[model samples]
Target: MKKITALIGSAQKKATYEAVREFERNLKSHTEIELEYVFLADYQIEFCRGCKLCFNQGEKFCPLHDDRDLIIDKLIHSDGVIFATPNYAFHVSASMKNLLDRTAFFLHRPYFFGKAFTSIVTQGIYGGNSIIKYLKNMGENLGYSTSKGCVLKTLEPVTKDVQKKNSLKIKKAAARFNKVLMRQTAPSPSFFRLMMFRMSRSSMKEMLNDEYYDYQYYRKNGWFESDYYYEVSLNPIKKMMGRIFDYIGHRMAGMN
Candidate 1:
């Protein structure tokens, strides 16, 4: 069975938690999955201290001793991952933001390539859409093939109509997430992802050395020479675009 983990940020068993449960059920209707719910409140993830040790050296060098790696291990072992959070004060809950902040180095050295990712955001009113977008982008940066996530307006005293609507939204999002999870082949990189890889690799190659963890990681992964993160046939046009992006990256690196 495929392993899917939902990292839920809410401390309470409320809208966000319920939404993830509904999502799990809907996803299982498509295929059998071993779903695990990780309540962030149950873990001891310390707030990030803004020390760049994880960036400059390695994540192991990070000073705080906590469960960050344990959570990351769960993500690494799962076939799919979900970030579920409630919108608090127009943003993701503190727990969710703290997790993201602690793992910010992943943005520099992404490690979850080919994993399926999506988000579930429950909100009282107007901010859930933006939270979904933020989580999706973060997933992509972490190297997951992300499905566009959903936002459910879950104002208190949710009427039956609201529950029904949220269920439909969850169902649709689960279907999309399941489809990505069941794909037989690696997804081809989109043009934007292609550009991101080419530009980042080029800039790192030009500007950094072995002293930097990011540089060492790119070298170890052979990203400096690879056409993309994984081998896929790129059309001639994209190949040309990749080279152009490389040139632009080189120029940018030189200017810094």
Candidate 2:
């Protein structure tokens, strides 16, 4: 059975959780996917120190030893991830931001692949699209297949009409998610994703020391030679483009 981790970035289980729960319920109807819920507010994550330990040395070398590893482990083991948050000031909430900040190192050394991602955003009326877009971009960087996302208008008091609309939308989104999640094979990376892989891997291999965790990770994963993070067929033109990107990235890192 596929496991899906639903992480709520709200301070409390209020509107955001409500929207996530609705999504879970709808997803369940389509399939028997196991669901795990992570309330970020309950985790003891410390603020990112900007010391670059996680980026340069390794995540294990981070100064703060909170629930970061535990959370990451949960995510790594899951087949799919659902990030839910309340829109704040036209973006994700602080709780969600904290989680992202702590795991920012993954942008440099992505590990997750062949995983599905869907985001849920609850807002009073506006900015849900922006927050959902942010999470989708994160998923893309982490090697995940992302759905467009689910946005629900959650004004105060929660009217019946709103709930009805939310349920309908959630079910529609879940159907699309489930269909993609159940696919037997993974798709090849987009040209943009290939460029990212080329740039990041070349930069790390050229600039980082052997002892640096990011460099070691690249070696361990054989990313230096692999065309992309995951196995897939690539056309010749795309391969040439990736080569160009890698050469540029190496030159840029060499100059730094």
Candidate 3:
């Protein structure tokens, strides 16, 4: 059975967490996937100190050590990841953002590959959808196969219509998440994704070798010689775009 986890980003077990539980219940009932819930409030993740060590050197060089690795381990071991959060002032709560901030290096050196990711967001009034959008982008940065997220309204005086709508949305999102998690392989990288790999690898190879761990990582992963993060059949246009990105990288290197 595939392992799944919901990283809860709130401090209280409020209506926000209830929405996440609804997602888990639906997913569990539909599939054989093993599910776990992780509350970031329970972890001792320190605030990022802006040292840039994780990007410049390596994660091991990060200044403030805490449960960051433990969180990452949960992420790595899970086949599917769900980021559950209560929108706080129109954004993800500090707990969720802190986790993302700590994993900023992954944005450059993605490794999750075929793992699936989605979001379950709850809000009192507005911003739940926007928060889910942010989660989708972050999931991609971490190299997870992202799916459409679920947005739920948790304001008081719950109307019958609102509750019914949330139930449908929860079921729909769970079904989508389940389907993607069952997909054993990651989807083909898009043109922009390919360009990102080409530009970063080339820039690191030509410059920044002594400045960032990504340079060594690209070399070790053989990404310097490849067109995408993983092997995939690329169409002619995307291949051409990749070469153009490489040319741009060369130009940037020439300027250095």
Top candidate when judged by lDDT against the true structure: 1
Candidate 2 deviant stretches above 4 angstroms:
none
Q: Which candidate would rank higher by TM-score, 1 or 2? A: 1
For model 2, what is the error of residue 81's alpha carbon versus the real structure, in angstroms, after optimal superposition?
A: 1.1
After TM-score superposition, the amount by which residue 225's alpha carbon in candidate 3 deviates from its true location, in angstroms, is: 0.6
Sort by lDDT, top down from the best? 1, 3, 2
The digit string of per-residue lDDT tens for model 1 on 55-161 reads: 98999999999999999999999999999998898788899899999999999998898789999999887878888889999999998989998999888899999
lDDT of each: 0.92, 0.87, 0.87
TM-score of 1: 0.98
Give the candidate number with the greatest TM-score.
Answer: 1
The full ranking of all candidates by TM-score, starting with the best, is 1, 3, 2
lDDT of 2 by residue, 69-166 (tens): 99999999999999888889998888788888999888887767778888989989887887878899998887788888889988888899988998
State the displacement of the C-alpha of residue 14, model 1, in Å, after optimal TM-score superposition: 1.4
lDDT score at residue 162, model 2, on the 0-100 scale:
86
What's the CA error at residue 51 for candidate 3, in Å? 0.8
